[model samples]
Target: MADENGETRRQRNERFEFISPELQVPDGITHVWDWFWQLSGRRHSGPEALTFADVGEWSRLLGIEVLPEEVQMLMAMDDQYLRAVREDQRAARERAQQQ
Candidate 1:
C-alpha cells in the first residue's frame, strides 16, 4: 500500500529504518522520524539532545499530536539506532587499526 505521498510501505520502511515495523501508526511515526532526522542533521546527537519542550514544539510544527507512549517509543528507537551506529563505528576503527 502506498501512503498519501505515494511512497510504498516497503520504501517508507527502508527510508525510516529506525521506526518500528510493528507500529500501528506508521505514518505518524514516519513524520516524527523525519522531523527528528532533520532536527539532528541525521546524527545521533540530535535525538540525544531533545527535550520535552522540543517534542511539544515538534507537535506544533508538524500539526500532529503524539502521545507520550509514542514519544517513548521514538526515544527507545533512537537509543537503539545510536548503539548500532556506535558499534559499527567501533568495528570500522578496529579494522583500520588492524590494517
Candidate 2:
C-alpha cells in the first residue's frame, strides 16, 4: 500500500537513511548508495565485490576521499541487508512448499 505521499511502505523502508552523528561527510549518501548499487550490480552480486580497491576507485571517481570507516559502514549495511533478503526468500520458499 502507498502512503499519502504515494510512496509504498517497502519503498520508504528501502530508502537509504544515513544517521551518523559521527563520521560526518559533506557529500550526500545517495552518491554512495548509487555507487554501491553500480558496484554490486543491483545486489545480483555479493558484498565480496565491495573491496578496498573498489572503495578507492569510488573515492577517485567522486573526486573526494572517502574515509575507511564510512566504507566499512556501507559494507556492513549491505551485508546485513543481503542477509535479511536471503532469509525472507528462504521463508517465502518454505511457505510455498508447505502450500
Candidate 3:
C-alpha cells in the first residue's frame, strides 16, 4: 500500500539500495554504500566511474560536509575496492541473517 507520501514500500526500499549490515564500514561513512549506489548507474562500473563532482553532489544530498582530505580519498577509491566493500557488507548481512 502507498503511504501518505504515495510511496509504496518497494519504492521506499528502492530509494536506498544499500543493504545495511552489522559490519562497520571503513572511513566511518555510514551512508557510503547508499551514496555509491546512488552515484553509479550500474554496479559493474565500480566507484572509479564516479567523479569528484559526484561525491560533492552526494555530500550535498547527505547534508554532510566533506573535507578536502575526505574528498580526495573518496575520489581515489577504484571500482574494485568499492565492489569488494559492497560484497563484504552483503556477505556479513547474509551471515547475520542466518544466525
Candidate 4:
C-alpha cells in the first residue's frame, strides 16, 4: 500500500541511502555496509576485479579501515545475493530520482 508520501511501503523499505562520497567510513555504518557500497559503485563504474584483496585495497585507498571480521562477512555473500542487493538498490535509486 502507498504511504502518505505516495510511495509504497515496499519501496521505502527497499530504499538504500547512498552514503556521501566524502565520508569514507560514515558513522553508524558497519564495515560490511561500507564494503558493499563501494563494491556496488565499482560495479557500476566499470568491470573490475572482485576479490577480498581488492576490497582491502579499496578500503585503504579510501582511508577507511575495515576489521577482519567485517571483511569476512562481506566476502561471505555469494554472487546471487550481491546481485539481488544491487538490483534492489538500483530500483530504489530510480524511484528516489522520480520524486
Top TM-score model: 1
Which runs of model 3 end up more than 4 angstroms from their true locations?
1-48, 79-99
Give lDDT tens digits, candidate 1, residues 18-90.
5645636477467666665554553434225455676677678878778878778667766776675566557
Candidate 4, which segments miss by more than 4 Å at Cα?
1-31, 44-49, 78-99
RMSD to true structure for each model, in Å: 9.1, 8.2, 10.9, 10.0
Worst 10 residues of 4 by lDDT: 16-25
Clashes of 2: 0
lDDT of 4 by residue, 49-68 (tens): 36877777788898978778
lDDT of 3 at 26: 68
For each predicted model, how many residue pairs clash, with residues at least 3 apart or on different chains? 0, 0, 0, 0
Residue-level lDDT of model 2, residues 1-99, one tens digit each, is 343467643665568463424435446576666656565663334334456676677579868767677688778756765675566557657968999
Once superposed on the true structure, which residue ranges of model 1 sit more than 4 Å away at CA?
Answer: 1-51
Give the Cα-based TM-score of candidate 2 against the true structure. Answer: 0.49
Ranking by TM-score: 1, 2, 4, 3
When 3 and 4 are scored with lDDT, the better candidate is: 4
For model 2, the local distance difference test gives: 0.61
- As for candidate 4, its clashing pairs are none
Model 1 clash pairs? Answer: none
List the global CA lDDT of all models.
Answer: 0.62, 0.61, 0.59, 0.62
Against the correct fold, how does model 4 do in TM-score? 0.42
